[model samples]
Target chain A: MIQAVLTAEARTPGAARLHAALMELKYEFIRLMRTRAYSLSVLGFPLMFYLLFGIGQRSSAAAQYVIAGYSCFGLGSACLFGIGLGIAFERAQGWLELKWASPMPRLVYLAAKMAASATFALIVMGLLIGLGVTAGRAHVSLAQAAELAGILLVGSIPFTALGLLVALIAPPKAAAGIINLVYIPVSFASGFWMPMRMLPHWLQAAAPALPTYHLGRLALGVFGLASGKHALEHWLVLASCSVLMFAAAWITFVRSEAKSP
Target chain B: MSATAPAIPAAAPPAPLARLREVTKRYGQLAALDRFSLTLRRGEVTALLGPNGAGKTTAVRLLLGLTRPDAGAAEVLGRDPRSSAARTAIGAMLQVANAPDTLSVREQIELFRSYYPRPLATAELLNRTGLAALERQRFGTLSGGQKQRVLFALAICGDPEVVFLDEPTVGLDIQTRRQVWSEVRALAAAGKAVLLTTHYLEEADALAHRIVLIERGRVVRAGTPHEIKHSIAARRIRCRTRLTAAVLRELPTVTGVEADRDGVVIFAHEPEQVLREMLPLDETIGDLEVSAASLEDAFLALTHTS
Candidate 1:
């Protein structure tokens, strides 16, 4: 009886690989949808912040600025906590070991995770835009909204890389706390909560060094809400930071894999 | 007890599915596997039997390519274990693992099924593991034994040529253990090669076609269960006697003795000689019985001797 059931052969190797990747992606998406706390933290917090601060401001200019700033904040958390904390917990629970033993491609596993994070980033951006137009009454054209959304999505790369680096190095129990420490301070110093000029003089001076600051500047630039001397400089800083963070993450991952049983 | 080697299988053996040649894996000063060698043959179940920390896991890890052996060669399906092609043809259930808590049994099965070129149908998997009724139950909600069955289901879902089950039934109840044992037997009966690691002497006795007894990173003995049992010269003699267990142990031919409500059970190379001395000394002796030594007794003798 068992032999009869074991006789079914697989499809072509190429098709099987493709099917496996798609299955992984689909399950990851399902996990995100089912995890309410993750959804609320990634999507709810940004929406709440936008509603509170963006709508509280009567001026259309302040409302538009709030939209861009909170969008970066929302997406940044979505990537950093979503991937970084998620992987850390998975590693601690031995899920990574099981996955490694499987025939799934390494790239496919990472792609699924990153794709899930990006999907959340897009959802958060959409909610913020909807709130900005209706409740906040901000003046923004379709082109502006589309451009800002593109910038936010691209801007998520550096943060995701940073998250991965932290997750690879931190113990699972401490991952969430460590991310919080990094997230809160980086967001505040990067001027995600307000304009750089409004922050303390020293923090404003230090803003350009932070990757979130560059992301914020680019996001604000799309809406004509930020005044930076060179837009290309912010892009350059972000690209360089992305490379550095990814390299760090790769090094940490390799070292840990070698050390673990 | 006969010390003679058991007869080798009369039929020609199938080609090897996996092999480890003089594999030496080390962790600092401790050698996890020291010049160890093993072969997993097609259509046979090999049990790697040992106590905890005896390097069963290290050997499994080396063969799975989870870790490289410090020296020696390891191969699966005639290819390096690390190769994707080699891995695609193998399935494993590690000692420690868990599926996503949010997913149901059916969902997790479907997810793992997609990883292999050839995978069992979801319905077939559920039916085989006796999880069809619990297919919709969340993984987090299942009992320990049920969870283990789920892992077992995933291990064979890929129709792997060689399946590695490392302590698959550990911590399960007797009924669950028997259920798992039957499934393992089914795997072998289906012509799949299986390498199972277990400390349960009964488990190895029941499921393994051949047992490899390892100690301190070396294969101390390897043979069929009957052969291994026959290799031990000890015979067991049980009798209700007035003599204390300590006095029974004092007998020259007695290697070991245990006293309980029923009687003093004596283990000896020459039980007849021990009995010759015992019947005269204990006039209260009754219910005397003699039997061949079991695999547990054999394991104790083998591990203690070398």
Candidate 2:
């Protein structure tokens, strides 16, 4: 009876893994989309801010400049709120334990969150570009627009990595509050809303420490609004941040797992 | 060769579908499971019956691979419980304070079903769980019992051969609790190995083919419900009498006396003899009731001596 009762399925095929991955992605997207507050603000924040300050008696460079800055802002918010808060809340709810008990690969759970965050970041960039072009009077060529989208897509990775660590550390009930505490200050310090030249000297000097500032530089460079730093330098910083944070988060996770017993 | 005959040899009994062999799990200095061992076979439901902090949930966690045992082995289908192949054959409904409330019941079931190679159809899972009418309802909007059913749907939707349910009926009403018991019985009837942990003694009596009473990481008693119940061999006499437990203990054939909200319940091998002595001494006795001893009496008796 035991032998017959057991599911004698063969090894998981590649197709099953692919299907699992896709399903994980689909649900991750749906999970975030249903949270009206999360989806609406992550999408609307950049567009609304651009309307407020990116246009009206703006220079051609200024309109484009605000587009680049707010696009980076949107990407940062999406990754932080979506990936960070999402993981923290799920982990707190004991939902992660159920997933771990299932046959779903652990990597798929993480990869889905990263992919979903990137998707939201890209959507916000699209919306911001549309707003900039129509009412804000900002001009963006197809090549530049593609470059902007690429920047957002890749730029979300380091933030995703950072989000992992935050999720691990933040208390579940206060995850949202804690994320905002870090998110708002870093965006302002990184000059996501204003040009670096206009920021206080200390703030500008401190901007390089945050990864979002590097992403901000990459976004600004699409419209030739970046400072004198080479575009390669920004890539190096972002890439290094992604690797380092991922390693740190992985180590932190492993240590916590060990300590639980 | 024909001289020796096999008259009526039955087929060999099936091996355990899931087992924890001499497992010891420790958290800091306190051992959650000390040399613990358990098994589940197909077509039978096993209940890990214990009070809170009695290591019942810890044993469930070890079997689910949510936590590793400090010593010994946890196995399912001849593989480590943590392995993907083993997990694919297993379903679990853990004690979660909140499931993701945003998704509708159907959506949650569908998502869990996608994790397995062979899964029950959405309609079938819905039908089995009795959630057909509420499939469109979000988990957040469900009552406590309905949410528990949704979790149960997620657990069984994978058509798993072995299922682990950790305190599945906690906080549920008695009617809902009975509904869960019926579902558990169905799982056993369908020949799926089911292991559930519960503090509810009646739940263990109603659902489990075998019950293991754990205390402080040790199995104090493990037997069939009938075997355990019959072992006490006592009748329960309940009454609001002026006689205290200390006074009741002096009487003959009195095995145990427990003070509860109902009243002072006296357990004895001869209830009539105890009553003859008790009633005259306390003429004020009221709400007198007598019945056969139950599992709770067996528990109180076990605790009194142990």
| Candidate with the greatest lDDT versus the true structure | 2
Among these predicted structures, which one has the highest DockQ? 1
Indicate the worst ten consecutive residues by lDDT in candidate 2 chain B. B297-306
Cα distance off (Å), candidate 1, residue A36: 1.8
lDDT of 2 at B59: 86
Give the winner by TM-score: 2
| Every model: Cα RMSD to truth | 5.9, 4.9
TM-score of each: 0.89, 0.90
lDDT of 1 at B12: 69
**Runs off by more than 4 Å, candidate 1:** A1-12, B1-10, B238-265, B281-289
Query: Candidate 1: which docking quality band?
Result: medium
Which digits, one per residue and each the tens of the lDDT, describe model 1 over residues A85-197? 87887777767777777777778887777778878887887787788888777888889888987887678778778878888889888988888888888898888898888
